[model samples]
Target chain A: MARSTYTLTIPSSTRFLEDARQFVETHAQEAEFADTAVEQFKIAVDEACTNIIEHAYKGNEDHHIDITIIIDTDRFTVRIRDEGESFDPTSYKEPNLMELAKKRRAGGFGVHIMRRLMDRVEYRTRGNVNEVRLTKFRNAEHRRNGDQA
Target chain B: MSNFSVGFRSSNSIKVLDLQGELDAHTASELEAAIQKCQDEQHYHIIVNGRNLQYISSAGLGVFMAYIEEVREQGGDIKIAALQPKVFNVFDLLGFPMLFDIVETEEEALSKFHDAHEEG
Candidate 1:
């Protein structure tokens, strides 16, 4: 199978999230992913980008977010790079649904949604750049069978 | 930019908000402000009509999460109705149905509100 990659860069602003989402969706479709999987990828990327814009850039519209998506036979990966403050995704705890319902907390749901939709999520900071990568397997059953081989 | 808008109305004492276009992190604040207006007026029984809404991100879902407890605490509830399947999937993915009253039509939501209010 041939490997394919696509890259997009947009200002770190909420206004550009729709464009970003469409970009991811288009590439995911081109890779022949299922419609449901494509939608999950779009949502996962949107949440990741939104967090970079809101938390990393602190809502600064001037910074830029670089997104790269690579599609292979087995899986697809989305890498987001932002020049902003570093954030440790591992340290963030999933909010308790019962407690959140009772408290009605306004934020903290973005990361949870991203984690639930994607198969893998990783975060790292390289000097001034913050990088977040999300991955989804094309065929979970196939991958599981292959792992046994 | 995504074309997003929110309109407000009242039906039988239930506040209804008609949303259109995309609701993401950027456009979520508009919906937030609209909900805030409803809260300020002490209108707790609310129904959000999402039939026209095309897309929604987690941020959009968070807006409802933000206000639900307070609204419920005031002896009212926030019910979502008429959501397109695609839009509803976002909420469903996050287990929103467990936390919200989502129905197939705005009428159902309004009726639910009225029934609860009458019973109480």
Candidate 2:
């Protein structure tokens, strides 16, 4: 069962990504997640926010991003909402590594990294807001150890 | 705010950059400027020392992708060395090892440049 929820709101700007990452790291640690898991969540959240700022908002700094983190005993979920352009995340494709290397592509890596780091990633658009939800499950053994500690 | 800074050095003809702190969207431009400075100077042989790089995002990784082709076309390459495991995982996940030469030490990267120069 989900025990608590934390929310943060920040401008749709790249400058706030570090703050967002720190927020996730602190909460993940308090939840007794492993260091590697914390790092993965940090990267995953950062990539998601970056995509919102750069692609969804089209580099507009005046927009805002609302982040909600839900914590359960064995899982962590993050929902990011932005009032930017509506786009289908399912349509986006991870660049082919072989082609990326041959052409030396500079972008299109953010979505790929986000998907790889999180256990589940889903996106939807409701009305004028676009939401991206990411979830990561804690290891069963690790959670049992954390419960004892 | 996340901190990021770059230090430049020269190993003979090779330009070595020591990256410190976080490399994300906010600070990626700083790296881009440093790479531009290298291009302006025509110092194509480049090595990025990531021993002090604590964190990196895709934006930071993009900076390297932006200039690699130009440097390689000029008969030089950008090699990364001493990447902290966390940083390396990001690159490795993206299959960057096949695209760029990532070594265990800065000395190894510098030596590879020397070897390539001698062969050509």
The best candidate by DockQ is: 2
**Candidate 1: where is the Cα deviation over 4 Å?**
A142-149
lDDT (0-100) at residue A7 of candidate 2? 94
Candidate 2 deviant stretches above 4 angstroms:
A101-104, A140-149
- Give every collision pair in model 1: none
Can you write out model 1's per-residue Cα lDDT over A71-90, one digit (the tens) per residue? Answer: 88889999999988889876
TM-score of chain A of 2: 0.87
How many Å off is the CA of B8 in candidate 2? 0.4
Error of 2 at A40 (Å): 0.7
Fnat, 2 decimals, each candidate: 0.63, 0.67
Candidate 2, residues A57-102, lDDT tens digits: the string is 9999999999998998778888999989876876888787666656
Complex DockQ per candidate:
0.68, 0.69
